[model samples]
Target: MLGQGLVDVFFEDGLNWEADLLEDTRFVMVETTAYFEAYRHVLKGLQEIEEGQFPFEKYIIACENEVSPPKYLRNRRTVQFDLRPLVDENIVIREDEALRRQRRIVNYQFSAESRCAESVEILNLRSWPRPDQLHLDQSQYEALQTALTKEFVVTQGPPGTGKTYVGLKIVKALLHNASIWNSGHQSPMLIVCYTNHALDQFLEGIDSFFKGNIIRVGGRAGEDMAKHSLKVKKQALRKLQDMRQIAGVRFNCTKSMMEVKLEIERSGAQMEASEREILHEDMLRPFMDNCYDQMTCVELPQQQEIPSMMVEWLGLEQMLGETQVAVQQGREDDNLHDKQEDEIALSKRICNASVRLSTVTTKFVNPTIVLTTMPVHESSLLTSSNTTSVECHGQQ
Candidate 1:
């Protein structure tokens, strides 16, 4: 059994005690009954303390048994007991409340009502030309309509049943009426595939109809027409550059004014108050204004412009420059193989950098649609309040 004083000390410093013991020791052991008794004693002590009737001093006496007294009560004023080792061994194992709550929430979120709402009838589609003209059979058209009206709907079919074709049509119809479903800005949607090849094919279909902003995260940007490709490292570097530019303008302006002030203070000359004020107003204000104007006048490139900017920024243009030089040199050299090899190497480097830059700069473009393989769908980049994802899979 645990003394009340020891229980009080445990309540006050249990976390620190556990951490220190765990650092030096792999595990601690205790008797089953004594361990439970200690927990009960601590809880009782806490309740008594809360009720304003705690008997702290009454339980401070050292026991005659081998179990030492608690560390806090070991001073000369009262009974001294070395109870640290005894109590440290008797830690109670309990379920983590927070983790339990999280699991419950996840279970609820994946339930039938949350994953797929009840199917509802949609209005006639004769007024909508593209959806009406889609080559879906009656069942495929009904599935398409159900997806549009329901908050969450899953489409399943065997191979070669026009599943993808009908899904694309539904996406197109949703994109056309996006304003009705969401706020009048962009409609954020995610398309997830089981493989990179499937992701590319899905993006191609989206590109054919949906002309809004699209960002592709993960894997290479295989198609030249892909809107945005995000390469991790180069994108991180670009973000760092953007941060520096934002801070450099204000920092340089402040530093310039400070230098002028220091110069004036160092010049061993007495000046009237009005003259010093005039010097500051004349020297500092215009320079600062000019700096601000210069910074603001520069317009940052739009998302569509990032590919071109990356070509220049990543030195792809320099590789092209070498290619031009190689072409001119080829005219003078009879060894055509050397010219061909040089051109191939340079072209490969340029192409690789182009794909990387396209991948890295994708997030900045605020794409309305994102297509990624299922393995990478859980990436933090894809989770946004405004976005919704659709997962497509096929039997292996």
Candidate 2:
């Protein structure tokens, strides 16, 4: 179970507890905020312990960051913590009832995230090819470590059947169709293939983009990353205004500044207890103005609910768009053999990567077990008793 609470106290340092790990410890992942508090509390508590006061149990903390998924290499259920909650309320715990009473500050990120602990999604592809949705007979991804997911299935097909070329198309289909995490801005899907040859081919199919198309996302994934790359970005700002209903700090900004505003507002990061100076009304006003002028219309989507994963799809489109257009033009400009030439090197690379993922989908799709038989005489198989089960192939 995910342990959450305002840190009434904390413990850290290499764990000194002596217990059978598999039986006693449960796997734990804590947020970054929780991490800081746990460390600080433990450090302080340990110092206090050395001074002959705080309890001894709080000293041995072998805490790891939230990203480190605990492994049971030797059957130890580990605990990880994120102390993001303690950013501003550390020393001031006396005022807050949850902190005073030592209640776990179980926020939405913790609660929502706890439900997805075991079945996290991971990607395994390495490249892309043209016409990404090209269908194979299926079974190409049977060997990839991360490709085998109970939540999803992998398919394999031969070169003409579209195994490599179909990566981006599949991603787009999933983004538009199956995704439950359909945030308007979140479009980060990847189309990895085993070979650069396949990569080039995949690129050839997707880039036939006409000008002035918003949905033809190919290369703009980085824009979203740039827009939101922050130590903190806020979501659910309305909730904070409710939290601050009593102590109203006057603030306003144009619609343009709303992105940055939403980020900070969404974070709800309390800083009152920190050494840093808090933002006064006047000081924060100009920041909004600057952000307003800097904000672009393209950055503001009509859909706020879009997932960032969508951005990757868009980027993939733009990248593939450019590539597909080039391929079409190349076929027009050069000899027909150019397509084969482009594929030869990549086909070889796929051969090597096939230890984990195959290049030719046919190898995967066809059954490995063979039924052996000798060639029989055509006359014996097609005797007059067959009564001419005639099939017509009429031609002019």
Candidate 3:
């Protein structure tokens, strides 16, 4: 009643509202949007019901008693009652109008015509391949066979009879025979359960063996499946994109720096051969020795240094030394960046993030298997898909 939007006279914490009896007051029941979302699936399921096909008749109940009954009055007394037409047409038309509006937009995701012919045509279970790994009893095998050969199946048993075990086997069988059911495209499989615990157990089992795209829609999943939730996947995808972009920008900067370095080297090489020789032989010796050993050094050993040309050359060499250090640092940074990039790529591949989604169309864009509860199944966020083929495996 809380999440489904029903009128309640008490607070959520089991407390009743108190009003001043001496003052004028009014009680109001405000409508919320929860009912609309909760009942949207009903609208979709009832799409085939046409006008005048509503199963229930509209009637108004009236109490004809003029005197008030005692607080202790029980079933011992009978009161006069009358059933009449709902003359206030708004009462009846409101629900009808809401349903009409919902019906206009409710597009059915599943249809009977899309079912596989082989699913209904197959009569013998011996025609299907049986894996050596599956160890199922007669009942479990029969249930799995029914699931593989039929469009819909319900496997019911007590707690310890391996209902979920058979469901997992059916999923495995479907994976093995996806081409027959999905027309060569390994489209998504939707598994709807009645509880979060059941959804978690089913998802963990699927994650253990099935290595394709899978996502848990609800937040109450166990820790093992938390990282695979749609919200977490989107966040991880965004972080991956951001890191890649930053790495790209840094790479461009490193490339520009290397280009500038190459230009400097080219300029140094363009000097006349004799001039280069002089700078190498004459200038370098005096500068390294810090003495007037060469004619380029104008003054005494301790007083003045090399010539202005030599001095300028030494300054350029110092600048080049600093640039080399920067280049080395950039290279080191790039190495670290590459390592981080590799780690991210590995994690993405493991999480199926590589094929997961780069944009809105990317998530669930591949052959996906979604495990969720009944409440989440009704949620538009989980059931929304444009994929043409959907294979469902049910267990109860």
lDDT of the structure predicted as candidate 2: 0.36
TM for candidate 2 is: 0.17
Clash tally, candidates in order: 8, 75, 1
User: lDDT score, residue 107, model 2?
Assistant: 30
Candidate 1 lDDT over residue span 1-396, tens digit each: 256522322425445675555533443344464457536776776766643354332333332234333232233342211111111222112223364455421111122221112112133334222323344577787787566544445689899988887777666645543434433344477787766677778778777655456677666666653445666446877999999998999899999999999878855343554454223323333456665454435465574332233344444656756766898898668568878889999999876655211111122226554544344322233434554444333221
Instruction: State the lDDT of candidate 3 residue by residue for 1-396, as single tens digits.
Output: 878965445443455545433435556765675667655667676886775564431221232223222222223332221100011111111112354345432122323322222232234445433322235577776786666544435589989998987887666545534434553343577887767788998988877655566778766888988977899989989999999999999999999999999988865774655464444444345346645445344454464333344544455645655766899999999999999999998997776632321111223445874433332232133224553323333332
TM-scores of the models, in the order given: 0.30, 0.17, 0.39
As a whole number from 0 to 100, the lDDT of residue 216 in candidate 1 is 76
**Model 3 steric clash total:** 1
The 10 consecutive residues of candidate 2 with the worst lDDT sum are 85-94
Q: What is the lDDT of residue 268 in candidate 1?
A: 36
- CA lDDT of each candidate? 0.50, 0.36, 0.54
Each model's Cα RMSD: 42.3, 42.3, 39.8
Q: Where is the poorest 10-residue window by lDDT in model 3? A: 82-91
Top-lDDT structure, candidate number: 3
Name the top TM-score candidate.
3
